[model samples]
Target: MPLVSPDNSATSSDEIMRYPFDTMRTVAATILSNVSIALSEHEIAWKKAQDYVQSLPDPLQPAFMDVLNKHQQRIRDSYKWQEDFAGALFNAIDTVSNTDSNISTSFQKIDNAKFTGFGHGHLIVADE
Candidate 1:
Protein backbone atom coordinates (compact mmCIF):
# COMPACT_ATOMS: atom_id res chain seq x y z
CA MET A 1 0.00 0.00 0.00
CA PRO A 2 1.18 3.52 -0.75
CA LEU A 3 1.27 6.23 1.89
CA VAL A 4 -1.23 8.90 0.94
CA SER A 5 0.54 11.93 2.39
CA PRO A 6 1.73 14.84 0.26
CA ASP A 7 4.75 14.02 -1.89
CA ASN A 8 6.62 17.08 -0.71
CA SER A 9 7.42 18.41 2.74
CA ALA A 10 5.05 20.89 4.44
CA THR A 11 7.64 23.66 4.00
CA SER A 12 7.22 23.48 0.21
CA SER A 13 4.09 25.52 -0.22
CA ASP A 14 3.74 24.88 -3.96
CA GLU A 15 3.90 21.12 -3.68
CA ILE A 16 2.06 20.90 -0.38
CA MET A 17 -0.79 22.93 -1.81
CA ARG A 18 -1.40 20.44 -4.59
CA TYR A 19 -3.71 17.48 -3.95
CA PRO A 20 -3.22 13.98 -5.37
CA PHE A 21 -6.87 13.27 -6.14
CA ASP A 22 -6.14 12.26 -9.72
CA THR A 23 -3.43 9.87 -8.66
CA MET A 24 -5.70 8.32 -6.05
CA ARG A 25 -8.53 7.91 -8.53
CA THR A 26 -6.21 6.28 -11.01
CA VAL A 27 -4.94 3.83 -8.41
CA ALA A 28 -8.45 2.89 -7.28
CA ALA A 29 -9.67 2.43 -10.83
CA THR A 30 -6.65 0.34 -11.70
CA ILE A 31 -7.30 -1.90 -8.72
CA LEU A 32 -10.94 -2.34 -9.65
CA SER A 33 -10.00 -3.11 -13.25
CA ASN A 34 -7.53 -5.70 -12.05
CA VAL A 35 -10.18 -7.34 -9.90
CA SER A 36 -12.51 -7.46 -12.89
CA ILE A 37 -9.83 -9.11 -15.00
CA ALA A 38 -9.12 -11.60 -12.25
CA LEU A 39 -12.82 -12.45 -11.96
CA SER A 40 -13.00 -13.05 -15.71
CA GLU A 41 -9.95 -15.29 -15.59
CA HIS A 42 -11.48 -17.22 -12.72
CA GLU A 43 -14.67 -17.83 -14.66
CA ILE A 44 -12.73 -19.17 -17.63
CA ALA A 45 -10.68 -21.47 -15.43
CA TRP A 46 -13.81 -22.72 -13.66
CA LYS A 47 -15.36 -23.59 -16.98
CA LYS A 48 -12.31 -25.62 -17.87
CA ALA A 49 -12.52 -27.39 -14.56
CA GLN A 50 -16.14 -28.29 -15.27
CA ASP A 51 -15.17 -29.76 -18.58
CA TYR A 52 -12.50 -31.84 -16.94
CA VAL A 53 -14.90 -33.09 -14.29
CA GLN A 54 -17.40 -34.06 -16.98
CA SER A 55 -14.72 -36.16 -18.67
CA LEU A 56 -13.80 -38.02 -15.49
CA PRO A 57 -14.57 -41.73 -15.11
CA ASP A 58 -18.15 -42.53 -14.11
CA PRO A 59 -17.42 -43.45 -10.47
CA LEU A 60 -15.33 -40.27 -9.84
CA GLN A 61 -17.64 -37.83 -11.63
CA PRO A 62 -20.10 -37.43 -8.78
CA ALA A 63 -17.41 -36.61 -6.24
CA PHE A 64 -15.75 -34.10 -8.60
CA MET A 65 -19.07 -32.44 -9.33
CA ASP A 66 -19.82 -32.09 -5.64
CA VAL A 67 -16.45 -30.44 -5.04
CA LEU A 68 -16.81 -28.16 -8.04
CA ASN A 69 -20.29 -27.12 -6.93
CA LYS A 70 -19.02 -26.17 -3.48
CA HIS A 71 -16.09 -24.29 -4.95
CA GLN A 72 -18.40 -22.37 -7.28
CA GLN A 73 -20.66 -21.43 -4.37
CA ARG A 74 -17.70 -19.99 -2.52
CA ILE A 75 -16.71 -17.98 -5.59
CA ARG A 76 -20.22 -16.66 -5.94
CA ASP A 77 -20.32 -15.61 -2.31
CA SER A 78 -16.93 -13.92 -2.63
CA TYR A 79 -18.02 -12.08 -5.74
CA LYS A 80 -21.04 -10.70 -3.94
CA TRP A 81 -18.97 -9.63 -0.97
CA GLN A 82 -16.40 -7.87 -3.11
CA GLU A 83 -19.07 -6.28 -5.24
CA ASP A 84 -20.56 -4.59 -2.19
CA PHE A 85 -17.13 -3.60 -0.93
CA ALA A 86 -16.18 -2.07 -4.28
CA GLY A 87 -19.39 -0.11 -4.42
CA ALA A 88 -18.75 1.40 -1.00
CA LEU A 89 -15.14 2.12 -1.92
CA PHE A 90 -16.11 3.89 -5.11
CA ASN A 91 -18.66 5.97 -3.26
CA ALA A 92 -16.05 6.97 -0.68
CA ILE A 93 -13.60 7.96 -3.41
CA ASP A 94 -16.18 10.15 -5.04
CA THR A 95 -17.01 11.82 -1.73
CA VAL A 96 -13.35 12.50 -1.08
CA SER A 97 -12.83 13.91 -4.57
CA ASN A 98 -15.73 16.31 -4.19
CA THR A 99 -14.50 17.47 -0.79
CA ASP A 100 -10.94 17.86 -2.06
CA SER A 101 -12.13 19.95 -4.98
CA ASN A 102 -13.94 22.32 -2.65
CA ILE A 103 -10.91 22.62 -0.37
CA SER A 104 -8.54 23.20 -3.29
CA THR A 105 -10.74 25.99 -4.59
CA SER A 106 -10.60 27.72 -1.22
CA PHE A 107 -6.84 27.19 -0.98
CA GLN A 108 -6.31 28.70 -4.40
CA LYS A 109 -8.11 31.86 -3.35
CA ILE A 110 -5.80 32.20 -0.34
CA ASP A 111 -2.73 31.36 -2.40
CA ASN A 112 -3.52 34.00 -4.98
CA ALA A 113 -3.87 36.78 -2.43
CA LYS A 114 -1.07 39.31 -1.95
CA PHE A 115 -0.48 40.22 1.66
CA THR A 116 2.26 40.71 4.19
CA GLY A 117 2.49 40.78 7.96
CA PHE A 118 5.12 42.09 10.37
CA GLY A 119 5.56 43.37 13.91
CA HIS A 120 5.60 47.17 13.46
CA GLY A 121 7.25 47.94 16.84
CA HIS A 122 8.09 46.45 20.23
CA LEU A 123 8.00 47.89 23.81
CA ILE A 124 10.15 46.51 26.59
CA VAL A 125 9.35 46.46 30.30
CA ALA A 126 11.92 45.87 33.02
CA ASP A 127 11.38 43.91 36.23
CA GLU A 128 12.62 45.73 39.40
Candidate 2:
Protein backbone atom coordinates (compact mmCIF):
# COMPACT_ATOMS: atom_id res chain seq x y z
CA MET A 1 0.00 0.00 0.00
CA PRO A 2 1.54 3.29 -1.14
CA LEU A 3 0.32 5.49 1.72
CA VAL A 4 1.57 8.29 4.04
CA SER A 5 5.26 7.89 4.83
CA PRO A 6 8.06 9.99 6.34
CA ASP A 7 11.43 11.05 4.96
CA ASN A 8 12.91 9.87 8.23
CA SER A 9 15.37 8.15 5.94
CA ALA A 10 17.62 11.23 5.75
CA THR A 11 17.56 12.37 9.40
CA SER A 12 17.17 9.05 11.12
CA SER A 13 19.25 6.85 8.85
CA ASP A 14 22.46 7.44 10.85
CA GLU A 15 20.84 8.58 14.08
CA ILE A 16 20.55 6.24 17.04
CA MET A 17 17.22 6.10 18.78
CA ARG A 18 17.87 7.58 22.22
CA TYR A 19 15.53 6.18 24.79
CA PRO A 20 14.32 8.23 27.76
CA PHE A 21 16.61 6.23 30.04
CA ASP A 22 19.63 7.43 28.09
CA THR A 23 18.94 11.11 28.83
CA MET A 24 18.05 10.23 32.39
CA ARG A 25 21.43 8.52 32.79
CA THR A 26 23.30 11.63 31.67
CA VAL A 27 21.26 13.90 33.92
CA ALA A 28 21.69 11.60 36.92
CA ALA A 29 25.46 11.51 36.42
CA THR A 30 25.59 15.29 36.19
CA ILE A 31 23.58 15.67 39.37
CA LEU A 32 25.77 13.23 41.29
CA SER A 33 28.99 14.86 40.09
CA ASN A 34 27.66 18.30 41.03
CA VAL A 35 26.78 16.99 44.48
CA SER A 36 30.29 15.68 44.97
CA ILE A 37 31.61 19.11 44.12
CA ALA A 38 29.10 20.54 46.56
CA LEU A 39 30.38 18.44 49.44
CA SER A 40 33.88 19.68 48.67
CA GLU A 41 32.55 23.17 49.55
CA HIS A 42 33.29 24.52 46.11
CA GLU A 43 29.63 24.59 45.22
CA ILE A 44 27.14 27.08 46.71
CA ALA A 45 25.21 26.67 49.93
CA TRP A 46 22.33 25.83 47.64
CA LYS A 47 24.19 22.58 46.91
CA LYS A 48 24.41 21.84 50.60
CA ALA A 49 20.74 22.70 50.87
CA GLN A 50 20.09 20.19 48.11
CA ASP A 51 22.05 17.55 49.97
CA TYR A 52 19.88 18.14 53.00
CA VAL A 53 16.79 17.86 50.89
CA GLN A 54 17.79 14.65 49.12
CA SER A 55 19.01 12.97 52.26
CA LEU A 56 15.64 13.22 53.92
CA PRO A 57 13.45 10.13 54.02
CA ASP A 58 10.88 9.98 51.26
CA PRO A 59 7.98 10.39 53.67
CA LEU A 60 9.41 13.46 55.48
CA GLN A 61 10.98 15.16 52.49
CA PRO A 62 8.57 17.85 51.46
CA ALA A 63 8.01 19.50 54.84
CA PHE A 64 11.52 20.95 55.25
CA MET A 65 12.00 21.65 51.54
CA ASP A 66 10.92 25.28 51.91
CA VAL A 67 14.37 26.31 53.14
CA LEU A 68 16.01 24.82 50.05
CA ASN A 69 13.46 26.66 47.92
CA LYS A 70 14.34 29.94 49.62
CA HIS A 71 18.05 29.25 49.26
CA GLN A 72 17.68 28.96 45.48
CA GLN A 73 15.75 32.23 45.39
CA ARG A 74 18.46 33.80 47.52
CA ILE A 75 21.09 32.55 45.05
CA ARG A 76 19.33 34.71 42.53
CA ASP A 77 19.33 37.50 45.10
CA SER A 78 23.07 37.34 45.91
CA TYR A 79 26.04 37.80 43.60
CA LYS A 80 28.23 35.34 45.53
CA TRP A 81 25.88 32.41 45.19
CA GLN A 82 25.51 33.23 41.52
CA GLU A 83 29.25 32.99 41.03
CA ASP A 84 29.53 29.72 42.90
CA PHE A 85 26.63 28.20 41.02
CA ALA A 86 28.15 29.28 37.72
CA GLY A 87 31.53 27.73 38.47
CA ALA A 88 30.16 24.45 39.72
CA LEU A 89 27.66 24.18 36.88
CA PHE A 90 30.35 24.80 34.28
CA ASN A 91 32.79 22.36 35.80
CA ALA A 92 30.23 19.57 35.71
CA ILE A 93 29.30 20.38 32.15
CA ASP A 94 32.91 20.39 31.10
CA THR A 95 33.55 17.03 32.67
CA VAL A 96 30.56 15.48 30.94
CA SER A 97 31.02 17.06 27.53
CA ASN A 98 34.72 16.27 27.31
CA THR A 99 34.36 12.62 28.27
CA ASP A 100 31.10 12.00 26.46
CA SER A 101 30.52 13.60 23.09
CA ASN A 102 26.82 12.85 23.27
CA ILE A 103 26.26 14.99 26.34
CA SER A 104 26.14 18.78 25.88
CA THR A 105 25.33 21.80 27.99
CA SER A 106 25.93 25.44 27.29
CA PHE A 107 25.94 27.13 30.66
CA GLN A 108 24.95 30.73 30.35
CA LYS A 109 23.44 33.17 32.77
CA ILE A 110 20.27 34.69 31.36
CA ASP A 111 20.09 37.47 33.98
CA ASN A 112 20.74 37.89 37.67
CA ALA A 113 18.39 40.34 39.30
CA LYS A 114 17.31 40.68 42.90
CA PHE A 115 13.54 40.78 43.23
CA THR A 116 11.60 43.78 44.66
CA GLY A 117 12.47 47.28 45.87
CA PHE A 118 14.80 48.55 48.59
CA GLY A 119 14.04 49.03 52.27
CA HIS A 120 11.00 51.27 52.50
CA GLY A 121 11.55 53.33 55.64
CA HIS A 122 8.20 52.00 56.87
CA LEU A 123 9.85 50.15 59.66
CA ILE A 124 8.20 48.96 62.84
CA VAL A 125 10.69 50.57 65.20
CA ALA A 126 11.83 48.52 68.16
CA ASP A 127 10.54 50.02 71.41
CA GLU A 128 13.62 49.92 73.59
Candidate 3:
Protein backbone atom coordinates (compact mmCIF):
# COMPACT_ATOMS: atom_id res chain seq x y z
CA MET A 1 0.00 0.00 0.00
CA PRO A 2 1.07 3.53 -0.75
CA LEU A 3 0.18 6.98 0.61
CA VAL A 4 -0.29 9.84 -1.82
CA SER A 5 -0.59 13.53 -1.10
CA PRO A 6 -2.91 15.91 -2.94
CA ASP A 7 0.15 17.60 -4.41
CA ASN A 8 1.27 14.23 -5.83
CA SER A 9 4.05 14.09 -3.27
CA ALA A 10 4.87 10.74 -1.76
CA THR A 11 4.15 10.72 1.95
CA SER A 12 5.17 8.26 4.63
CA SER A 13 2.61 6.13 6.43
CA ASP A 14 3.84 7.66 9.68
CA GLU A 15 3.00 11.10 8.32
CA ILE A 16 -0.44 9.84 7.38
CA MET A 17 -0.91 8.48 10.88
CA ARG A 18 0.10 11.82 12.35
CA TYR A 19 -2.27 13.81 10.12
CA PRO A 20 -4.94 13.48 12.79
CA PHE A 21 -2.83 15.64 15.12
CA ASP A 22 -3.95 18.73 13.22
CA THR A 23 -7.52 17.58 13.33
CA MET A 24 -7.21 16.91 17.04
CA ARG A 25 -5.83 20.41 17.57
CA THR A 26 -8.71 21.95 15.62
CA VAL A 27 -11.25 19.94 17.59
CA ALA A 28 -9.59 20.71 20.91
CA ALA A 29 -9.45 24.44 20.14
CA THR A 30 -13.11 24.53 19.20
CA ILE A 31 -14.08 22.64 22.33
CA LEU A 32 -11.91 24.85 24.51
CA SER A 33 -13.48 27.97 23.00
CA ASN A 34 -16.92 26.71 23.85
CA VAL A 35 -15.81 25.80 27.35
CA SER A 36 -14.31 29.27 27.78
CA ILE A 37 -17.68 30.83 26.98
CA ALA A 38 -19.39 28.47 29.38
CA LEU A 39 -16.91 29.44 32.09
CA SER A 40 -17.88 33.07 31.62
CA GLU A 41 -21.48 32.07 32.14
CA HIS A 42 -20.44 30.07 35.20
CA GLU A 43 -18.89 33.21 36.64
CA ILE A 44 -22.15 35.08 36.18
CA ALA A 45 -24.06 32.32 37.89
CA TRP A 46 -21.66 32.25 40.82
CA LYS A 47 -22.13 35.99 41.29
CA LYS A 48 -25.87 35.50 41.39
CA ALA A 49 -25.50 32.68 43.87
CA GLN A 50 -23.35 34.82 46.12
CA ASP A 51 -25.85 37.66 45.92
CA TYR A 52 -28.68 35.37 46.88
CA VAL A 53 -26.70 34.03 49.78
CA GLN A 54 -25.91 37.53 50.93
CA SER A 55 -29.52 38.63 50.68
CA LEU A 56 -30.67 36.24 53.35
CA PRO A 57 -31.97 37.58 56.67
CA ASP A 58 -29.32 38.36 59.26
CA PRO A 59 -30.17 35.35 61.44
CA LEU A 60 -30.24 33.01 58.42
CA GLN A 61 -27.02 34.40 57.03
CA PRO A 62 -24.85 32.32 59.34
CA ALA A 63 -26.54 29.07 58.34
CA PHE A 64 -26.47 29.95 54.69
CA MET A 65 -22.85 30.96 54.87
CA ASP A 66 -21.99 27.75 56.63
CA VAL A 67 -23.55 25.63 53.92
CA LEU A 68 -21.94 27.67 51.20
CA ASN A 69 -18.58 27.44 52.89
CA LYS A 70 -18.72 23.67 53.17
CA HIS A 71 -19.82 23.17 49.60
CA GLN A 72 -17.38 25.70 48.21
CA GLN A 73 -14.50 24.14 50.07
CA ARG A 74 -15.37 20.74 48.69
CA ILE A 75 -15.62 22.13 45.19
CA ARG A 76 -12.31 23.89 45.53
CA ASP A 77 -10.64 20.77 46.82
CA SER A 78 -11.96 18.71 43.94
CA TYR A 79 -10.77 21.28 41.44
CA LYS A 80 -7.35 21.37 43.05
CA TRP A 81 -7.08 17.64 42.64
CA GLN A 82 -8.17 17.88 39.05
CA GLU A 83 -5.64 20.63 38.42
CA ASP A 84 -2.88 18.39 39.71
CA PHE A 85 -4.10 15.53 37.55
CA ALA A 86 -4.19 17.74 34.46
CA GLY A 87 -0.71 19.02 35.18
CA ALA A 88 0.58 15.48 35.32
CA LEU A 89 -1.13 14.67 32.03
CA PHE A 90 0.37 17.73 30.37
CA ASN A 91 3.81 16.82 31.63
CA ALA A 92 3.46 13.34 30.22
CA ILE A 93 2.38 14.73 26.86
CA ASP A 94 5.25 17.18 26.85
CA THR A 95 7.69 14.34 26.44
CA VAL A 96 6.21 13.32 23.12
CA SER A 97 7.96 15.75 20.76
CA ASN A 98 9.62 19.12 20.54
CA THR A 99 7.88 19.97 17.31
CA ASP A 100 4.85 22.17 18.02
CA SER A 101 5.65 22.04 21.72
CA ASN A 102 4.15 25.53 21.86
CA ILE A 103 0.75 23.98 21.39
CA SER A 104 1.22 21.88 24.51
CA THR A 105 2.57 24.89 26.38
CA SER A 106 -0.47 26.93 25.43
CA PHE A 107 -2.76 24.20 26.66
CA GLN A 108 -0.86 23.88 29.92
CA LYS A 109 -1.14 27.61 30.58
CA ILE A 110 -4.83 27.68 29.77
CA ASP A 111 -5.52 24.62 31.90
CA ASN A 112 -3.68 26.01 34.92
CA ALA A 113 -5.25 29.44 34.60
CA LYS A 114 -8.75 28.08 34.20
CA PHE A 115 -8.42 25.59 37.03
CA THR A 116 -6.97 28.15 39.43
CA GLY A 117 -9.46 30.80 38.41
CA PHE A 118 -12.44 28.55 38.96
CA GLY A 119 -11.02 26.90 42.05
CA HIS A 120 -10.67 30.27 43.79
CA GLY A 121 -14.25 31.11 42.84
CA HIS A 122 -12.95 34.42 41.59
CA LEU A 123 -16.24 35.08 39.83
CA ILE A 124 -18.26 35.26 43.02
CA VAL A 125 -19.41 38.59 44.45
CA ALA A 126 -17.10 40.12 47.01
CA ASP A 127 -18.30 40.14 50.58
CA GLU A 128 -18.85 43.53 52.17
Q: Which candidate is the best by lDDT?
A: 1
Q: What tens-digit string does per-residue lDDT give for candidate 1 at 1-128?
A: 22345755666544523345566567667667766887898899999998998888999999988988998889877876766666666777778778888988967765765544434563332222
Name the best candidate (by TM-score): 1
Q: Give candidate 2 regions above 4 Å deviation.
A: 1-42, 80-128
| lDDT of candidate model 3 versus the reference | 0.57
**Pairs with steric clashes in candidate 2:** none
TM-score of every candidate: 0.53, 0.25, 0.42
lDDT of each: 0.71, 0.53, 0.57
User: Any idea what lDDT model 2 has?
Assistant: 0.53
After superposition, candidate 3 runs with Cα above 4 Å error: 1-41, 96-128
Weakest 10 consecutive residues, lDDT, candidate 2?
Answer: 104-113
Q: Give the winner by TM-score: 1 or 3.
A: 1
Question: How are the candidates ranked when ordered by lDDT, highest leading?
Answer: 1, 3, 2
Kindly give the stretch of ten consecutive residues in candidate 1 with the minimal lDDT sum.
119-128
